[model samples]
Target: MKSTEPVCQYELKAARDAMEVIQGKWRIPIVISLTYGTKRFGEIHRDIPDISPKMLSQELKALEENKLITRTLHDSMPVTVEYALTPLGMSLRELLDELRNWGKHFRGEIVGK
Candidate 1:
């Protein structure tokens, strides 16, 4: 007999987990910034001036924990750390791009400005 489920429970769980990782005010912006290339903490903070250091740190930690990004530390004179998107995170670029196109279409239809 066929189970006839739209999606497996594990697939649903994966979807929910992905959402949780990216579901935050600053998370998407942070991810988008890293999509281009690696960035240092100060660079990210400067790019997002509205986000407090504490909040940005929290989001970076969460993203790192979820394997969406990787943090590398260099043993230079003062020690340097940079963040780059993981393969999983980079996979979101296409999806986000599609969303951006959809948003533009919707805005044009509704706002018509």
Candidate 2:
């Protein structure tokens, strides 16, 4: 038996780039949390307590660079910053939802949960 499929180099590179953007340990969770609403750096840290500040900062920077998230600075008595999904990032919610459903389906089979 053999597989019959057409492979395009551009498609392959796009897939790899997409994976690279979301490949960090904390990226997915961070994205999921922010999907609900905008969050301050501290709020994101609290939501994902296992992630260190350094790691979270790094992940947020990477996501920003990938155009998946937007960082906004607010001017006030004291400066504040918030993170939110960009239009491009919001577009990924549907895909994430499907992935979540797939995980739910596989969890019991794989972990007896």
Q: Report the C-alpha lDDT of model 1 over 1-113, residue by residue, as the tens digit.
A: 87765878898999897677779789988998897789999999888899999999999999999888999999998999999999998988987788679989999999996
- Give the runs in model 2 whose Cα sits over 4 Å from its true position: 1-11
How does model 1 fare in lDDT?
A: 0.90
TM-score per prediction, in order, is 0.80, 0.86
By summed lDDT, the worst window of 10 consecutive residues in model 1 runs over: 1-10
lDDT of each: 0.90, 0.91
The numbered model that scores best in TM-score is: 2
TM-score of candidate 2 versus the correct structure, residues matched by position: 0.86
Q: Give candidate 1 misplaced runs (Cα > 4 Å).
A: 1-15
Lowest summed lDDT window (length 10), candidate 2: 17-26
